[model samples]
Target: MIPAAVDAARAALADPAAVAARWRADHDGPVIAHLPYDVPAELILAAGALPVAVFPPGAEQAQAHLQGWICSPARRFLAAARQGELAWADGLVIPQICDTMRGLKGLWQFLQEPAFLESYNLPRISRASARPYFASELSRLRDRIQGFTGRTADDGRLRAAIALCNAVRERTALLFQRRVLGQISNLDYYTLVRASYVLPPEEMLALLGGMDVEDAAVSKPPAVPVVVSGQLMEPLAVAGLLDQCGLSVVGDDLVDGERAWRTVAEGGDPLAALAERTLNAPPCAVKNGPVTRETYLAALVAERGAQGVIFLHFRNCEMENLGYPGTRDHLERLGIPTLYLETQWGTAAAGAVVTRLEAFREMLEGC
Candidate 1:
């Protein structure tokens, strides 16, 4: 099954034409706009829309259009959208995850050629108010989805959507468990998991269902197992740098990685389930639970048997960066070595960043 899943996933990766063909055949109705992280899958499914994440293809010329002033992740998303890579989208739901994303939303709203555009205003990350804020935002989002689709978000419809989303979440959580138990390499897991965002959920599930879970092989245990925490959208290069430097990231608390699909809300009201699922997932910078960011990082490290922790922050991510000093100090008290890397999104080069990672890895090994 793992081999089959690998084969299916590879098919999607190998032939763009095939993937496009499958997408065209399988996807009916409007494609919900793609964002980097934390868009509720239930909303898209309830509205009968496809949730696609927008990302650049890592080509120099493709990135040239984003040169100067604009942050890398923003440029990459914009470049991809502008180049008609997102032509399939019938409408866009842009979540204001960060300042660059907020700016990108404005640019997209202004520039796109007559498509439905909705902006999602996320609640500020805090320990006390995040859940209520998210619940309210979800309510607003449900209304907007109903308005756009010309359908009402009745209780029955929402409950059915919640059940379907719970299934997807369960499947995703199983995959993460397999990875966490050392049944799969981080590279293979990352490839499969990252592709989930861009591909349709059914296709992703099909691929996952086919993966060889039993008798799965594992890579050599990393000398330094690290838990990556905080705001990370396009951290492909950063992960690669860590890998190159002999530090294996066994787990992550980022929306794009392990945290993206960890929990399911079972039984009870649909809205309540939705709220539970959102709050119970790994910590987000925008979370307002009683759990501090430091607690979240320490918990992940402990659960995953990580040797150290790396807090990767994007430049101008005011909330996350401001909270870093405290987070670092708390991790230190726990006897977990922590490293903070402040980077401009999209500007991280694997080779250059690997040097610092290597030193960090050595520190972990010595400890």
Candidate 2:
């Protein structure tokens, strides 16, 4: 029997809009959708609303609205919005972390015209100086969210939201640890992770907190251990492919996976704490932080005793492309076998990806 938590997570991800509609009915508050690579969910929660991450499948029709060079996720998000797939959402937060994302804000504003539209400006460089600025930006976001919801995200509410989010992160980290230890399957682990993006944080906390990973009926994790570094993984099949090829993801720097759950805000001031959390997060490709991706991956691999490294990236994601060469070179120097695969989100290219992964796994076994 499927565990209730896993089943609910799968159902939620399968139909995010439906889930959002339910949240709207339950909370009587706005449902705000945000693009990935970091938008503060706590602020939205503090405003008495749900924060949903946009990760739509397939962008075939979205091509008409976007240039050919735009990344698949951007195209998919636009397509989803165009198709009324996101009609349940009352607001949209577009984080301007890169050129493509910056362009998306204008398209969304002109086309969709959500009730609440926010263009969040994320600092590319993570530094001490950036924290205060980011905290101010977060404050602005809180004000905007309050304006949309007619509910003030006051200091008390913000602190409560932070505590809830921190609990979710802690629970997620435990699931990840179990997956690395082969106590849970990849499907179970990732479903919960992705589902957290769509489900209300309070709901997610209940679901994850109630999960009994020890007693859940789950498939064995793959035997070959590896670490995956990338912007994100989508369409679910990419993670499934790792399991299919007998490859276990012992560690990752993927935005949607490990990176999402790795940190907790620390401080009495909620916005400043959130800023500190972002600045201190594991290195991200879009953020030119003090720590390099290569160094982070190396440390993760060593800490987890990974057998190999897989650099999976979304095709046409320029920010991820910029850091791949340096990270790959650094790992190669350390004698870490690395496989880099770039695929468009929701494309029928898993066959090609799996073939390459199989060869990489075989090479590792031979050694």
Candidate 3:
């Protein structure tokens, strides 16, 4: 059974805007909004502002703003702003990581002027020059954030924030290992991880620390250990299907999953640390800008002792489309079974997805 603390964390994730509203009321915070991917939240936290993720349930009335195969995440963020779900947000930080995100930033800037928005230029390649450029970007962002929040990003404060965040990741890593062993449900584990994006890390850390999970491994009737790679796992029914199939996600290369928590900021210089972690963290399909994800994914599969890999991509994501073929080939070459599927935030097409998972499981079992 998942602990009450974890249940509370899941509840907070379900209604993050409400939680942010409460935080603002209590802390006098200017909440900063960003997607679930890698953007330094420590900077915002160090600046005394709350960093909440812009994850609206669905993109209702957002089609008027976004068009031509725009991903649901972009549409949902716009819809949240237009529909007042993000009224608590004082600013939005859109990262330059994908086409959909870039379009979202352009549209958001054009539509809502006089709103403090920053189009963070996250690098495509982690080259020698990328570190300096990323550090400069972080400095500029820190300046704007200080000016907006009337707080200083002292080395002392930023380091404290980084320490807090790193501790949060360390605690989460424990839960993730338990999840792999089936000591915690995938739904519960993901709910806790997803909540970390929105909830105050200190508060989320306290909740995670309260989880009294047993150490015993609880395997289902039969299953294959699989690594799930994706930008974000949403609608969560996809994870539910994995649980149903008894396929344990031993590891992942998802932007929002292990990728975010596994790599924490390091160094005495907080800005440089954030930039370095951004560039050094798990390579994503878009962020790496090449075929690096294939090698990265293969390494994850082998390290996790996964029998297969499941590549989950948002429907209109170009980065994943470009990298999927090579990644599939790489795993196949290693004799690792794989499944690639396009998923949307709204529906799992439960029957279709579950049927596919069942068939995949059968294949892995035969192997």
Best by lDDT: 2
* Candidate whose TM-score is highest: 2
Candidate 2 overall Cα lDDT vs. reference?
0.82
Per-candidate TM equals 0.84, 0.95, 0.94
In candidate 2, what are the lDDT values of residues 13-128, reduced to their tens digit?
77888888778677788888898767889899999888998777554548788988888888888888888888878889998988988898899888988788898887877877
Ten-residue region with minimum lDDT total, candidate 3: 211-220
Q: Which residue runs of candidate 2 sit more than 4 Å off their true CA positions?
A: 212-222
Let me know the TM-score candidate 1 reaches against the reference structure.
0.84
Clash count in backbone of candidate 2: 0
- Report, for every candidate in turn, its global Cα lDDT versus the true structure: 0.67, 0.82, 0.79
lDDT of 1 at 200: 67
Better of 2 and 3 by lDDT: 2
lDDT of 3 by residue, 136-166 (tens): 9999989988888899978888999899889
Superior by lDDT: candidate 1 or candidate 2: 2
By descending TM-score, how would the candidates be arranged? 2, 3, 1
